[model samples]
Target: MSTTPHPPRHEPEPGAPRDLVGVGIGPFNLSLAALAHPIPGLDTVFYEQRPRFDWHPGLLIDGTRLQVPFLADLVTLADPTSPWTFLNYLKTRDRLFPFYFAERFHIQRAEYDAYCRWVSENLPRLRFRHRVDAVRWNPGRNLFEVDHTRLGPDGEARATGRTHTRAVVLGIGTEPHVPDPLRPLVDAPDVPALHAADYLTHRDTLLAAGHVTVVGSGQSGAEVLLDLLRHRPPGRERLHWIGRTPAFAPMEYSKLGLEHFTPDYTRYFHALPEPVRDRLLAAQWQLHKGIGADTLAAVHDELYRRTLHGGWPDAHLVPGVRVRTAGRNGGRIELHLEHVQQGTRSRLTTDAVVLATGYRQRPLDRILADLDPHLRRDSRGRPRIDARHRLVLDPAISATGCAVHVQNAETHTHGVGAPDLGLAAWRSASILNTLTGREVYRLPGRTAFTTFGLDQLHPHPHPCPQTPPARHPRELTPLADGT
Candidate 1:
């Protein structure tokens, strides 16, 4: 004789259930997001403050290709078999054959960003336009209670119900960093001082005025200045490119130099001591610094051409110069520059000033504010990160059994490769491994940053493109060798 069993009841409203929560949805956590998507019964939700995926959009200058190789794409570094690799994107567009024949080492930014969006749309786990407000440890359940505010349908603000998670990964990226001297002029009316990110939207106005002054020596400054000089009507405006460095810094991209961008190198870098790591970052900044070969060459060509057709307001390269002060002078920006090489100071009246200084990590204080007493800090007041990339909190939060893991935001405590594309896969996999408590460590020698061997996956082959090969300038050493 068999006994009858009752059917399980379901919720009538069908509301959201509690499980795992990911704080930020940048590329780092997105990589983990793709990994977590297929796991069985793993209810995971990721929150992104931005409405969509945008990586370095402001400086996606025309013909500006990626600094790293195609192998460093999102899924490629984590799962070679994944459908979202750069090679796979090319294949989907039927450009694989042409891409291989073209023999290009780098992929274009437009395509890279597009590919990331495609992956994001398919993930279905990401909650867009949502900002995490706070994370609290629930003592009774021993789980992470997360509170976030997300935009409801029709763009109106709605307070969504909270969810619980065993772990959380924070991958909030960096922001444009401005200097102290020009802080007041950030958005001043009529004065026109802005970061390079606003260059595209503000370009036409600045070009129409007359003189333009660009600050910083990194990729954005170089490219913005180059664009202004080459694109502005023949003799209308003067361009001033100033930098604190004695010379324009060329990005080091030799075969061995590029090893630092590889996972093998990042693992080795993370194993070093704190002081040694500091010394290494200072030494390698030059290797990882500044503009791409193609942009640098374009700047050189335009400069030379303009010199031949010389006149007033042609273009000026002021190296070893720093902006000491800036103010609005008769509806224009009057910048005081200290010519470091000559030990002399000079003034330049320009239509606009752009600060292209680099970005810094987004502080975790905003989201982690409520849990201040429970949070832990490292020797330098930085978040102490463990091998699994979990934040080492006070008392290690053992009684609660909750862990706060981070994704590639460990640069302050770890090293440079923390936020890079090279380690996306490895970091995601490690976090998963920790969450599952499984001994599966797929990527060899994994650290808080960098993953190895996923780019070499043989399962998915590159698809060919249908379009004709892209037209490039004369084959040059800078674009190829980059030495």
Candidate 2:
């Protein structure tokens, strides 16, 4: 037998048990990372394909706001009294004054993204650029066999490595889906067809042309169309925005509508049979599924402003119309349309087509491909998952002692709440409890506040020993004035 010594284990501490390996680093997984790190005896590591935090950067329109309220940040739902909460972030940044001045629960998408990065930076628990390729069950040891492909700091692929995890959480995010008609234009040279994800990156290239055509009626489509129309680079006619829907419907927003995003709704939806739940979600969450109210206002303002200019460049809402076909000819994309209501047809040739059709869930091929025969799949051919979010392994693989959990793939089972920040903290705590067979971090009011964030909300936060720094991290020393 070989006598090579292994590197130090990445466990929490000596004799600490291994818990979870989160497969993605989006806000959903990042929130889980934040909550899991504070747990004393659970060893958890989150893997991300990207080098750093990037949440829908292309969709980060200049004036777009968050869909959920600001209080629905990473840790609050799990621990309302947790220090790492968004409220605590506001306090640390000293923006609590400005934040309160706004008098709304929502925050700008940019600021929210920056806050996520700020929270991520202070926590040393996440592992970036580590993409999970596959997971297998080794039932003999009752642990998961994970194979990961990581990119080095220099942007080169490092050798694939192995890590053993008691449970695995798959948080692979969504992939952008564009219509078939526009697919040809995407690859053509100088054709300038793109998706909303590439909007900001390709703005200048698209703006160089005389006119632009933005398709789809969702938030991204509306935002890109308005931005192009309002901010014309030097000289240009108004941009053309086409829609399949009858009109641009602003997202539904109300106190009760907001509850549809809560964990309670999640449990309610999860209780229904698979097919019925899917139909209910599609009907109710349409507008709630897209942009927020503030963004609609900005788009309306721009449209109104252009109308007052008198010399309105040809822009048509063209309700009840859908694109029959799109072809690039003579340096222009010819869009043939069908008016569903009138039963008539028309065509528009434009410089470019910006598709905002949205995205689909990333596939589970590379990760679970090899073990295809040893795993159960749902009726729709997706992995059949358990309540704890673990993948039920086949008998052959079950003998190897492994269990795989999920982090992001839950639309069919858990509803849209699967990818939300609302459940991250609680989910992490649950996974930790399951893996370690004990409560790792005490929930607020579960016991008593003895740690950082929660304890501070008292007369003076925490053990009567700490106080808010005078200028927010300006002084490194402890405060004597603290109770």
Candidate 3:
């Protein structure tokens, strides 16, 4: 709502490369953009394929709220005094007093989306409708070359251009993840199966169906099922909610349990062996992937209300179930499901299926395909991401000091905090610090009460000196005098 005029679109000057060029303008890169806006001489630009910023548009259901608190906005966690904080947004709309009185910690998802859009509109150097085609290192110029296609309002390519930058940040975000067994049905035009990412768009159709089955038990699944339950009649609500977990469990929201998302935990997780890190990520799903307790309560409350003076609500809430296969049976859909715990199989014929199986990190190989040879990879064929969130590249590229940072795509390397919104600002600040070679926003050295490793307990043991000995290089040789 500020009266500042929109800055003109950026065009890279010939023979001059920018300090950084960000690809994909999702919340992560948007956070980077907001944090970078105040730097005195930092030259940065962010691009997105969409016309404007819209975070999970289809999942922004009414009454649905973010799991994280409002203070975990794009800039507040890293820089509360910044003009672009969420509080300032309310002030711009003249609703600051109302928001202050509301005393709401978790804001609605729609409001969060709107807040991001507001930042997207006001921030300079964001070029929407620009699709980055490829990225490659120009050995001759010692810079990264980015190729992009400019799309018109209709989404057709209108022109193509290239830009040069000393560093790059990839924030393309995630895509709707449909399970392998249900992929065919979701891909077919006639099938009713759709991922929860498009839940709002097809809510009306789902409600009109005779029977609807919601798959997966994450936060999205709970929200969608609750929405459908609220709309359907008490006895006629033929809804089924099933998932792979043992129960529709609540997320770990306890005070100390929440510390896993802190910078301290991220550093600890990063320092562990690669195999251990991989095993830990697979076992820590409940930390960030479970349903919120409030949402679970709402679901329970709705079901209990329906049973006031009648039989049950014709709803089946089952966990430990997985969809083995799915197909179209005339106008209906048939889902072959298995109970992981009971080892039982059943065929469910329903009018619709919503796969809230959650989202996977969109692979970056396509965008960085041209630079594949230069990127270092793990045994699993994944790129090796460093503690600073930059992709580990070959020695030749590293020698140039040109970095390729990733946003929301480092779960395998940084633990559950990688994709979390609560850590978005901190991660962005960290990246900017490395990119600018200066502390633009001062960050805390430690952010948790719990010491993560054994070394913290025996800092100076009986066998070791009270004062720590000076550190030496890993390959340091003994002195010539052998003293």
What C-alpha RMSD separates each model from the true structure? Answer: 10.9, 12.3, 5.3
lDDT values, one for every candidate? 0.72, 0.70, 0.90
Tens digit of lDDT per residue, candidate 1, span 1-483? 111111213222243544568888787888887776655566788998788888777777777787777887776666777665677667767888998999988878777888788778766768898878788877677777888887865656677657777788888878888888777679576677778877777777767766888888878888888878867866664778889888887888666566565555654565566677667777766765656777788888876676666664467787899889888888778888898979999889988787887787788888887667776775567766775687777674744556888876777545666877776877787788778776343554322233333332222122432432332223323344754
Clashing pairs in 1: 91-463, 94-464, 94-465, 95-464, 95-465, 96-463, 96-464, 96-465, 97-464, 423-450
Arranged by TM-score with the best first, the candidates are 3, 1, 2
Candidate achieving higher lDDT, 1 or 2 = 1
The order by descending lDDT is: 3, 1, 2
Q: Which ten residues in a row have the lowest lDDT in candidate 2?
A: 446-455
- Candidate 2 residue spans exceeding 4 A from truth: 1-17, 233-236, 285-287, 309-313, 395-402, 433-483
Which candidate number has the best lDDT? 3
Question: Tens digits of per-residue lDDT for model 3 on 1-483?
Answer: 553323534544655788899999999999999898877667888889999998998899999999899999999989998888999889888888998899999999999999999989989899999999999999999999999999999999999999999999999899989888989888899877889999999999999999999999999999999999999988899999999999999999999999999997998898888999999988898999899999999999999998899788999999999999989888899999999989999999999999998988999999999999988898899999998999999898888899999999999899999999999999999999999887788787557778887543323233434444432224435567875
Runs in model 1 lying further than 4 Å from the true structure = 1-19, 152-156, 308-313, 396-401, 439-441, 446-483
Per-candidate TM-score against the hidden true structure: 0.83, 0.82, 0.93
| Candidate 2 positional error at 75, Å | 0.9
Instruction: Give the worst 10-residue stretch by lDDT in candidate 3.
Output: 455-464
